[model samples]
Target: MLGDDGAGPLLAEKMLANPLEHWHVIDGGSTPENVVHQIRQLKPSLLLIVDATEMGLMPGDIRFVDPDLIAELFLMNTHNMPLNFLIEQLRDDISEILFLGIQPDIVGFYYPMTDAVKKAVEQIYQALNLHYIQKAFEPLAICEQ
Candidate 1:
């Protein structure tokens, strides 16, 4: 995994500080080909990928990355493989796939994460807890027989 390319794992680290009751925080690193097998074993209802992806926006800008929009992204700072390629591998087993991409400021050795990206990480953590995760599960019905 590349240095700043560890964005998703880093974000997962910060979010795990308070620790959600039902969430499983995993740092799959930059290349998670094997992690896909683990995810398939667990069979979670939703799968969200958080990463540093340049989308031609401000350095700290965060956006919902669409699989179709992969080609248009500016991802020189990321690792060799495109995330959408990994997503495709999981598509057969994963019903819901969502991506949270943060634009990066720096992407090399020994450099601390940018203040802007840090703020975006905090914002995303709050957004996931306060809004999105709940909404994602709203449509599912529990059966009691």
Candidate 2:
């Protein structure tokens, strides 16, 4: 949870209910170094970052971003954190790394989330159980292979 206000709380709720069941909430008041230290110590299998960014799908939209961008951000932001080195750093630890974002209508001060973002949060929570094949990119047709 990287946001300063409402986004953090909403994401915390969803993560608490997540089937995988590990949740940590760090207050935005904390310094980035504190955050980096905590992550290093815990070594979470999946680091789901919910931040205010220009990137990502709007409310009610979901998409898997290329992992390369993920690596770039982690490196530049966290003082060359190990995740910057290679996806393999997470390979032995994390199996899935997801960045669930809600395009913020407001950030930095407390304000109610936009109706669209709120609806999206709920939708994502409900859809968490939808079965997705573990490897969806595999060729399904013989000719394609």
Listed in order, each prediction's TM-score against the native is 0.80, 0.49
Determine which window of 10 residues in candidate 2 has minimal summed lDDT.
136-145
Per-residue lDDT of model 1, residues 41-77, tens digit only:
8787788877887656667777665665565443443
Model 1, runs deviating above 4 Å: 1-4, 72-74, 133-145
Cα lDDT, all candidates:
0.68, 0.44
Residue-wise C-alpha lDDT for candidate 2, range 27-143, written one tens digit per residue: 332232335556556777666554333333344343333455655443122222333344444445666655444445444334556776566556545544353322321211222
Error of 1 at 20 (Å): 1.6
The runs of at least 3 residues in candidate 2 whose Cα sits more than 4 Å from the true structure, single-residue gaps closed, are 1-5, 15-48, 56-60, 71-92, 131-145
Clash list (residue pairs), candidate 2: none
Top-scoring candidate (lDDT) = 1
TM-score of 2: 0.49
